[model samples]
Target: MVAPGTLLLLGPLLAALPGLGQGQGQGQGRQRRPPPTQSPLEKVAAQEELSLPQLAGKWFLVGMASHCSYLAEHSHQLEATAVTVTVLDGQSLAISTFRKLDGMCWEIRQRYLPAQAHGRFLLKGRGYGSKVDVVVGETDHSSYAILYYQKGRSISVKLYGRTIRVSDAVVDKFEQRVSAVGLSEDMTYYFPTYGFCDSADEFHILDETKP
Candidate 1:
């Protein structure tokens, strides 16, 4: 089990249930609170001059934040995550997200439009009959990167490190970038590494690819 010290749950607070063996006065659980809501923002502008080829390696998800929306829904159950982006022929990009859920391996695949401009691309598939716009705000081409995506009110901010354990300085840098993008610092959550990739072929690539 992941240690409570390492698990960071941002956004809305979970339901406050009573402690497992508490005194009679402490047995009552508090009423659950509702999650916050976020209004839609204006069109998101992309960063300039991103080299897709350089981002084509594996990256681990270290932290994430989002606007007050369902943007983080698909990712909440996921832990120990990694992403691999490969350029296939010309400007077409092959993207993969690898994660583990309760000790089970899960993956998703999506393809981007051929014309990616200023680090902006429309990804047509996101596992489960979904689509999204991907914006890479900043990346060092290695070490760490900040990724953003939104479709309607669902906005996501992802921080990727070369490995699971990055220095606190790196985390601070990512938080700055997140604030620059208009997200609250309290919403940012840090992810832990479990190193759960069973094998090279363990990642389940979505069958949305053309033969």
Candidate 2:
């Protein structure tokens, strides 16, 4: 079962419609105000071999959550037309995405360094108009951390890996990590259109392998 607070976030996703439109606009207006810029994960991705081509191909959206209701609502509408990751240097990465929502394409160029374990990838970039940190998990054949965004009292999760769905055991372990972070359980939801790991037609593979 999803937590009450999480349910509020998931309500928009399940409905398949944008939610809190006016509220979101107001929030963005407030975000325009200059805030402190320092990221905890900046050092992590830089120290490690955070390669972009290594992240190429299709990635499944396992789950995502954000405190901002507007961002949460927009998340449901997020569909990637194409994702391109390039290793700018030993300590930086350039990520470009063609999204279907606004038909507006954008790219994020980030520099990072290593932080502590837990496979954290710290990053600093200018794309969304602020300093952001992206914490990534250790990479393996099936799973890896995509990125993490943290600002003041809010934090958003972005997990990108080979498949969207995991085995029951893996899901259980991931949930434990999420709970420890004080993130509400129900706040997380998968992108079903992308398909899961066990499915015959995984969106990441199909979309990437296509000519």
- On lDDT, the candidate that comes out on top is 1
Q: Give lDDT tens digits, candidate 2, residues 140-190.
A: 434544456666446666555465455666556556545545566666655
* Each prediction's whole-model lDDT (CA): 0.68, 0.48
Off by over 4 Å in 1: 1-47, 68-78, 114-116, 126-129, 198-205, 208-211
**What's the TM-score of every candidate structure?**
0.65, 0.51
- Model 2, position 10, has a per-residue lDDT of 79
Clashing pairs in 1: none
Q: Any runs in candidate 2 off by more than 4 Å, and if so which?
A: 1-57, 74-82, 102-129, 194-211
